[model samples]
Target: MDNNGPAYHEMMELHEILNFKTLCLVKSKMMSGLVFDQDLKALMEKDVKQTTAAIQDLQSVYKPNGGIVH
Candidate 1:
């Protein structure tokens, strides 16, 4: 309430989003390796990169102990 950061509830919501993005990132990275089609692998790699950036942005906004979650 005093740190000018998001409210506790808002932080929790962001945490959920961060977790989901992280999962997507992980899955895409794994799937990209398993994909046989070059085009599909490229697409999954792109998704992994985008998800990594999204998670970084969310971490900047949702830091709880002045550290990135996970």
Candidate 2:
């Protein structure tokens, strides 16, 4: 096993997490537009921002052959 990269199982798990976070980010952004309450909309926006960051971090760690997919 290579020391610098994640194992196969770990990479698969990370890929799943990245997909989930990407979905959450997209949903939050879309739903925020429909939210009437300012507080709820703000919260959803915050979630979008945080989820975006999480996806980026996950991509950084889960690179295959030193490159991200997107």
Q: For candidate 2, lDDT tens digit of each residue in 5-68?
A: 5567777777788888888888898899999999998899888888888888887777766434
For model 1 the local lDDT of residue 67 reads 38
What is the alpha-carbon RMSD of candidate 1 to the true structure? 3.6
TM-score of each prediction: 0.82, 0.82
Model 2 TM-score, 2 decimals: 0.82
Q: Which runs of model 1 end up more than 4 angstroms from their true locations?
A: 1-3, 66-70
Residue 58 miss distance in model 2 (angstroms): 0.9
After the best TM-score superposition of candidate 1, give how far the Cα of residue 52 lies from its true spot, in angstroms: 0.8
Q: In order, what lDDT does every prediction score?
A: 0.80, 0.80
What's the C-alpha lDDT at position 42 in model 2? 85
